[model samples]
Target: MIRIGKSVIVLVLLLLAARPHVYAQATDVVALTPTDDLLTALRIESSLSVFIDSLHHRTVRDIQVMPFSPVGRAVPNAGYTSEQARANPIWLRFRVQNATNKPIPLFVRVNFWCFESLQLFVTQTPEKTSAQTGSEALIRLLPPRVSRAVSTTAVDSLPGLLAASPVVGWRTPVAARPVHNRHFFFPVTVPAGADYTVYLRTLKVRGAQVVPVSLLRQAAYETWMQRDYLFWGGVLMTLLFVSLMSFFFFITTRDPIYWTYLLCVICLIGFMVINNGFLNQFAPSVQFWLPRQNCYFLFPLLLFYSNLVFVRTFLPLKKTPLRWLHRLSAGVLLAGLFCVLMLVVENWVQLSSPVEMAFLRLFTLFYWLPMPVMAAYVVMSLYRRYYRSAAWLYLVAITPFYILNFGQVVANFGLIPTYRPLVNFDIYAATGLFEVLALTFGLAYRYKLMRDNSDRLLSSQREQERTTFATEVQTLAQKNSLLEERERIARDLHDNVGAQLAFMITSLLHIGRQVEQQPIVNGKIQAEQLRTIVGYARDAIRTLRETIWAIQQERFTLAEFEERLNQYVNRYVQQTNGLDVVVEVEGDSGQPLTSAQVLNLFRIVQEALSNVVQHARATEATVRLQTQPNGTFCLTIQDNGQGLNFSPDDADNGERHYGISNMKRRTEELGASFRIYANAGTVVEARREAEMAN
Candidate 1:
């Protein structure tokens, strides 16, 4: 292989040295070898075609005799140095020979889309000089007297329903470019052993001026097109799926972020549809008359605005000092809106030289630079926050998108020189696919975050409700207790104090009557009655004082209960002469009791002491209080006296039974057990268990 390469280079050098002009021109020619004997399909670099400067709109007759240079490689920089050169058509020249015994069909393809026109002319070289090789052979190649021309049209026009719709941005008309595909293809047939030179003139209205052409056999062209169709079909279907899926999410979630992302995806989808020529192939009348050039500009601007809105919706920036970023984003959105208006004007004005007008359009269009700048700023800001929030998803998802586009932009602006034959690579497909998929994941993550937050909020509300319910129950219980206490107080004041006062009033009236009857009365009965009246008044006053004290107290512990019991017993023993009482408290526990419990228990103790003092007829009595560890308690009162045996449920046994009944009722009301042992000495015991706490 090395020796062959060396020999070929030496032969080319010798040929160039012997006949520089002929060999150089001959290098551009494509030889048609027999297809069967060929070991592999040949790869022809489209850049090898001869380039002729045809700025003046030259006809085929005029172009055939034109001179060309080998250095005029990539047509984009093929001396587009002046307005006149930019205005003219690009002319590509190729020479092909059919070495097979039969006529062979050859296809010349321009792989780029949206060029306005292409024309191919085939002129046969004289057979007499076909085998000649030198300046003489090269000279004979010019001034073709017989020729055939092929047009850019690939299909014929149809009437009525099959006609292209009259709209704003449809592709080159079906009549103008009968080929329904994006790329231009021209087919030509060369006779056996015949040599011919072909010229292709392509006219582009705007954008890049690169003209790339390929030569292919009939089988190769069909196979290439079949593969191309399958790839494009799959791409379009996938984009459609993404667009529909995004739209569905926006509809169901009603989320502004989803809506924003949907708009972005829609723009990208539209850009792909128009740029790939599907709009030219498959719509009603197969038309795509929209402002194709401006749409290319408009879609990117819309995408930028949507992306900004998407970021803003998810970030918690409103309360921060960086809230100014919101206004900055709005400014970028406004710039996008303004660029849209510029595009609208371009479409409406439809200028002759759109490339010149598009220069300013492009300048204003990139004012959206702030959109990506804002994205970078937000990413850094969120990173500085240590990725604590869901905003990090946006950064992770779109990073690859910007990275890929940045490289595309650099290459698009020609920051790096084109060093070899340029191949068309679909950067749009790569970046757009990655971006949408990553963004979809980001949105899903955000949704999960939202659901979690909602769950926490609901749980908090439920806990608050439980607390409020417990408080309400406690309050109701307190109110009920207060009403019950008021009723008890009413009964005590009426039954005890009122009855004592009545008896005192009666006694005084009787004494006064006896005194009136006797004139100067000093009777023993009268003196005793007066003394009895005074005792009744004193007893009533003491009863009122004790009732007031109990009512004023809110709560009591077991220790306080013991103290109060001791005081009551001491006072009672003083009032009743010849009576001895001892109060004993064991285990001075701080066990808490409700106000109602304390009042009832204290009153029970008072009733027991009164029974001993008035009825027991004994000199000694004892009150004992004890508390257990299980939040339960016991209290006992007993005396050394003549014990009377009776049951509280038995028929009423006069005034004596009333006090006993009261003590039993009070103990039962407090959820405690009461027992009286009628033996040598009376014993009353009360036991209470723990109450459930709120």
Candidate 2:
């Protein structure tokens, strides 16, 4: 479970780290909006020859003009005709322009007779002038030349008279004065019975600037809106991701750092969104209170908080001055928060203007500057600890953000010419990318730590294996030495005891034969000689039996077990002259038992027979070995003679003898059972339990 959690955290970190470079490679544009105002304006100016210059100084040509209002048809007098003539009808024209060399399309607005306070012209009418008799009002036209003109007897009537009813006129000035260094009006008036001349000429202008001023304003508004969406959207996503990661890490690892970092990320994301004007859209009422001027400070404070958390987690400088640095960062961020609170409470009146806002923002930048420096310090510290790769990753992650954020800082202070463009390219969007990169670096460092730990664990495991192997080897060597010593002792016992016992037996046999051949002076002396020989023979037999039993028990095998039992029975027959001992064996002869079990069973059988020989004193004895149906081998020694008068208490009280006790103990040692009783005579039974099937 521990391993699984680490893997998940590492995976999430890796994904976050790789997200920035992957997204950057795909595309830079966040959104695009299309507008037709410029096109509509250009189409209206088709008849005019105008040149427009764009911001890049490119020229556009062949501007045309179209009427804003079409000329109305002449109508019969509906009221006092002469009074109607005093009023003038109004008409408007629009111009279309092709400002680019390659014939770009344009739309323009051209106000007609705008300077005249008389009624606007509603129609175009043809009428002969009294001075020219048959000649009508000429419609003058100009060629590409500035002064060239042509005439058409197109219109010469009062603009008001041309329409059915007279129109009212304003007693105000014919032209509006330009405001804010922009000429916002175009005015033209045609007199009654006069040739109306329209001149067209090309001007040196950039085609791109041919876009109407209104359209430019609209574009900027849309761009600002898009930036708002992207900035806040990114901040929200980052907050959510950080929150989720925090919860995950906390739950999985029970780590406090992840939760702290999550809190810091949320605060930082909030600060950034508010500082960037993103929050303004959603909470427009707060805009009046939010100090736009303090954005500079807010942004750096956010960075300070975010980077401080990152450094504390990544480097864990918990002791000494390094720890104090984290505390200092937090203090700075708190100071920034206090500044924000002051600004909010002051209703933004304290900042007063963009300049004041910019100054405060610059001040905030200074506060945040320490975070990156501290990050660098952390990276350097890690490098010194042989975490060079992790340090490099940290450096790479932070560098882009540092440079871009610094650019923003500069732009905020009005050090840059254009604010929005620089902010778009350098700060707002770039910060998101940088954050993702930094997260990736963090993941990489974690992975390196995991790899190093795994390597260490593997090394430790290998060392443990080596130690275990050496211990096992030493144990085996000790066991081998013990076995050798036991074998030497067994050989010595067999050689010394067996040889001495055999020699004594031979001398006793010879002495018995010599005594039998010798003449006896008295019956008592011969009797004494006979008793001495018998005693010598009994002592030798006992010694030989003890030696054989001891030797056989030490290294008894399956075959030796059967042979020893047969020898014991034969010896009993020879010793008890009137007693008959019969032995029978059954079951698979090829079947084998382990040496320990065989030795145990052999000792059990020897003890049982010894008990019968010493205590039963029966006339006949029968020993039967048989395999039972339960897969166990059973041995029964029975004597048909005078039943022993011993009680069961004798066996329990250690009064009966050691022989029965030894039999019981040996059988138990082999995980078998021993049974002894005196039914008709003495009966001792030992059974060897079979090995369990695998």
Candidate 3:
């Protein structure tokens, strides 16, 4: 199938390169009716015989004698179908008669840029007689013309001519004026009462050999040129303005779509100007220097690349669930690769030798592949409702180009005859204008969507923050209420129980004094007992006061607890003059202590000290509070005296046993380990992890 397709493509190219298929086209013969001004006539041959002429370097005089087909007669509003012409030198035979009484100077204008060389030949008597028999004389139209033209390369160079730069006063006074016109002009003066046959011939290395001919007198031709210039100039200016505005938008917003859009517009403008033959006039340097394939492929390639990129940015495929967008991007890339490949092959064939089969096959593939891929993407976009409004607008914008270019491509495949309107009018430009405009609006719409999404996200974030703040405020209020309640409880305990304890301690001291004054033996013993009770009552009041202080503070730090413990120990030692007490604190004592931890720790210390003073009969006792680096809090109380003779299992009656049991119970309540043993005197130790204290 592939081989068959290749053969078919080659045959089609051959047919197009050979000549228009000689078939009878019933075209009306219109006379060039002259007026005072130049006469406008579209008397062109419908069917033209193509002869491959290689006398490219020959002058007009030499080409005049060259044989050309004698069959063409100019008919009004007639054109050779675009498919029937190929990119090669071809001579078109057509006749134009001066149908007026006076002599008229006729001008011919060929309007397209594919023709690299064009010349005119006019004769009163054609080589053939009848129009019907002239069709039979289409063979052997030309033999290769070999001519030696004089060369001027041997001229001697002057001193200044060979210099790298021109001398200050040596340059010629030549004014540089840029030409602004399209269409190759040829003039012929025909005598009245004459039928002049004209042969129009041209050569090219690329593009279709389409010749759009029009006959005009001098005044009318000038008027046409003026009008054409004005129209194209206005169009170019509008595109330039659009490009500037797009650039401005790009600069201000830093949006890549605007930059791409501006470039696409500029390329579109250049495509119009170049393909319409305006570049030959405006930029002769580019026309002469740039390769034909480069010029031909540039604008279309840029159009496809920029347009696809813009569309991708406008409606990103990654954001959608649709899978075909990947295929679309791949298709676009493939199309571009094929286009470059085809151009390379064409340029290689021109520079070296013709490989007609590969050239036609690759060219056909390049031209035909992009259309379906683009069409599929557009259809899918519409069906999926992707960028729905923009999709519809894009559909409407590209419709004309698709319709026109499809016909042209089909004609190239020899599937249908070439459509005349596609050759004469540029529907691509018309559709492209709308496409760019729609895309501009689409870019704006896309920006709006992004902004809306950003705004919504910002709003949601702010609302979440507000909710978090409100929750935090409520939590703080609850904490404050709890703190106030704790303070009130501490105050109540201080006012009632503390006052009653103070009164009991005072009354006991008074009773001790009164009993001492009695002076009887039993009375002295009673007074001593009263004094001991008073000492016990005073210790109880101090403990109560410490408990109250711990309760009042929201947080009791270990440092503050240690300070209170030292004061209590000092008070106990001071109450007994015979005993000396030592309090040593080690490590960090600034760790925070909870209320339960503070109360239990204080009670344990008080019990240990009271046991030392009342039962140990020791002269000196030491209290050590140490905090380890691993957050271990240890309390140790040791006395230098005769130790208690109590077993660890004795939990029944002795004061020593009761004291040990009470300290052990307090240590257990604090989640600490408790141990008591005699080492020199007696030592009581409690250990707890600081975090567990909380």
Candidate 4:
């Protein structure tokens, strides 16, 4: 009686479990039906769970299961709240039952794009606990077949294409795959019968992991892929266009800011390519880096640090009170450099992988924390400095990133509803575009400001030069008037005083001869005194003539001065009665002499000549003036004379030093060197170079 009870109980339990499967088959809880020339599939509600296998046994029956809630937050849109689960290897269970008139051969398309090591299982009906084989057994059952490529036309007749079981595999390595239309397709045979359960196991998953599981007809999946590719192609085209334009501006403007901005934009583009799964699509090997979070560390480091430098270059912080901001920006740049080194060591140096990864992750977090703060500070400082337009540009540039990162942060923590379309799009690229445009305009404005400042400075300098020129002209006119007065006095002395002295000397000579003829003693002494007076008058007349000649001219060129020296020497030699004089002018000085220089040079030559004629008592004299190759003017006066008959004591007592003193003083005033020696004769030499224009 006990055995009969056990059998009846078993039959009742089987019937009870079978009832729901029958109802599910009739009501279509999760089945993909072909309609509108596309595959329409619905997921079974609340059938997801995490597979926890604590025991050493790896069999499917030994696996422990927990309920899987993909989204744990309260969703007002869905009118429900679900409990969150920790990141773990998850399992999804779903059933497909065909309630149509014919057998449906449809493939299951699971967008396990963001998952790793996913395994799909199909059975007529899942038992409470069943011993299972490994994934190879399933691979063997659904072997790859030579299936025809799917076309859009085939989607309308999906029922006909669903005859054979579909092959299940991966386009890239399972580890690095992220959801970007990289769906896993599993072909199934769902005839008009009981339901079949499908199992998806994802291992070692992390975060608010989303598994976009769906079922699709093969033709419909292909059509969807074409559309997806087209959309991404458009995005790529836009990025390329913007990048090219940035470089073009950089080339034209020659600004480092534009180049840095361009690099930041390109890095952003690269990041989107990696994040959106396009890089993995092309090179599946990149999946290895995803496990290490290199995608998070590398590209963002480039973009963020490049932006920092770009901001520094854009702002006028170097000479401003807010220059400290530039230093902080530099510190951020150094930190970024350190992060780059850490990433390189982690990825390529083959170090202790865990430690390297930890360093990279920590640095990445720290780096981003200061970035927005720095940007905000830059904007506020610019505004404070009255760079309002630049501040507006900065605000525009950073707004999109602010929205994106903030929204992503809140959504990841389940603080807000995750808006997939907004979060998934490359908002950084959009922000980068705006920033590049705004900065380009700002740079243009800066250039204009520089140009205006330069023009103003030039005008001020020209005005200053004009004022100086006017002052110099007035001073020169006053100097010329003073010189004219001196010339007038010299002419009066030469014409009147000079003639009177000559006439007095002649009258004294005549009276002396007449007194000598009469022979009276007192008269003889008086006549002797008169003859001495006549001699003194003739000496005075010679001195007066020289003074008059010197004060006559306003200027004397080197050639004219040499001519005057020759004429004076010839006249003095004639008066000396047998003194032979040689005057030679040699070489040409292309530069002209100023009035002061000419006066000083002429006076120096005059003193040398007077000393030779009056005191040297030389029978032969030569005055040679020449210009050296280096523009030095040299004058030498030599005479075969009773050379300076004076001792060192005589010079110290200021005896016979008048002419030497005058020559030295004039030479010093002209910035020339003077030398005198009593060798063959009292030789005097003066050397000078032309002065440069003021």
lDDT of 4 by residue, 1-694 (tens): 3343346345434433332111122223464444424544444433333334333124332332433333221111121111112234445556666655566666655543334345555544544224433323212222222222333353223221222222223334434322234445566667665466665554322223445455665556567677667766766776677678768767866767767767866877776676556665566566566434355346756766776776676665766777676677777777788877765564555545455446635664655755665565655665586565565566555555655555544544444554442344434545555555555566556656766876898898888888888888878976775675455445435543565576776777777686777866566667666766666576567556655555566555567666666676666554545677788878763445545555556556666766776788887888787765555777788889887543322333464575566567666655677788787888887778666111
| Model 2 regions more than 4 Å off | 1-235, 288-300, 319-365, 410-421, 425-427, 430-434, 437-606, 612-670, 675-685, 691-694
What is candidate 2's lDDT per residue for 455-491, written digit by digit as tens? 8998999999999999889889767744743553354
The number of the candidate with the highest TM-score is 1
What TM-score does candidate 3 reach? 0.52
Candidate 4 Cα deviation (angstroms), residue 118: 3.4
In candidate 1, what residue range of length 10 has the lowest lDDT sum?
Answer: 158-167
Model 1 deviation from the true structure expressed as Cα RMSD, one decimal place: 10.6
Per-residue lDDT for 633-669 in model 1, tens only?
Answer: 6778888998867665651467757877777777777
Candidate 4 error regions (>4 Å): 1-65, 70-88, 92-116, 122-198, 203-217, 283-296, 315-322, 347-357, 382-386, 426-694
Candidate 2's TM-score reads: 0.42
lDDT of each: 0.60, 0.44, 0.58, 0.55
Cand. 4 TM to true fold: 0.47
What TM-score do all the candidates reach, one by one?
0.70, 0.42, 0.52, 0.47
Instruction: Tell me the lDDT of candidate 2.
Output: 0.44
On lDDT, the leading prediction is 1
